[model samples]
Target chain A: MKRVPLSPLRAILARQLRLLRAERGWSQERLAAEAGLNRTYLSAVERSEQNISIDNLYRIAQALDVSAARLLTDL
Target chain B: MKRVPLSPLRAILARQLRLLRAERGWSQERLAAEAGLNRTYLSAVERSEQNISIDNLYRIAQALDVSAARLLTDL
Candidate 1:
């Protein structure tokens, strides 16, 4: 299988998500549980190795206690 | 083909995108062109009939002159 390159926007999002999670002092496992997602998948998303679905993003934003817009702002 | 259900967040995004487009007096064709996407695809996205990719969402946000966060805010 061929690997697709990660889009720059996703790179920014991955970085931003990491910062937000760190700011909240939450581990990847904790955040994934709160967001009702698999920890491994969340790890891939944070590493910009996934094309995260919008629904998953929404759930993660809700778990992070921020509006989705705020989560992706400037990214 | 079987249809996938539209997520609530995507429904909100569709409504917001329509409102924003209307406010700007731009047609789907125009927005699609500006966002560098297919008009048909954009139409489906606006109708909440497609699971829009985050990359395309980012492009559309750029064309809308809003942060991706802003676009998904309140959605």
Candidate 2:
């Protein structure tokens, strides 16, 4: 299957999410659990294959103990 | 038809988008054009009826000359 390229914003979000999770030393699975999201979905999100909705971003931000805005700021 | 209640985060985004647009004295149609989104879709987003994707949020932020994080921040 051909892989679709991520939009610049989505790429930024993916990097931000991975960085935040790394800063906390949390595994993707653990963060997914905290965010009430499926682990596979969260992993896909970090891969920039998902155009994650705001509510899901809020969930990840809440799990990371950061503002959703923080995840979005670099864009 | 029954209206769905906005999630708290979505509601905040709606209010923030509207506030920012109002602050710039831009009408919804104008902002939508600037953001390259359909006017009706932008209107629904402003009304908290859309769970806007991160990419679209980025477009709106770019249009408003605000950080995407700024829109997602209140959550």
Write candidate 2's Cα lDDT for B1-75 as tens digits.
Answer: 212234467888888998899999999989988888889999999888898988788788878998787886563
- Give the RMSD in angstroms, all C-alphas superposed, for model 1: 5.3
Candidate 1 stretches with Cα past 4 Å from truth are A1-7, B1-6
The list of candidate 2 runs beyond 4 A from truth reads A1-6, B1-6
Return the top candidate by DockQ. 2
For candidate 1, write residues B27-66 as lDDT tens digits.
9988988888889988888887877768778788878887
Q: What proportion of the true contacts does each candidate reproduce?
A: 0.51, 0.59
Q: Provide the overall lDDT of each model, using Cα atoms, as 2-decimal numbers.
A: 0.78, 0.81
What i-RMS does each candidate reach, in Å? 7.4, 7.5
Q: What is candidate 2's lDDT per residue for A1-74, written digit by digit as tens?
A: 21223457777888898888998999998898888888999988888888899878878887888888778656
Query: For model 1, which pairs clash?
Result: A69-B69
Every candidate's DockQ is: 0.32, 0.36
Ten-residue stretch with the least lDDT total in model 2 chain B: B1-10
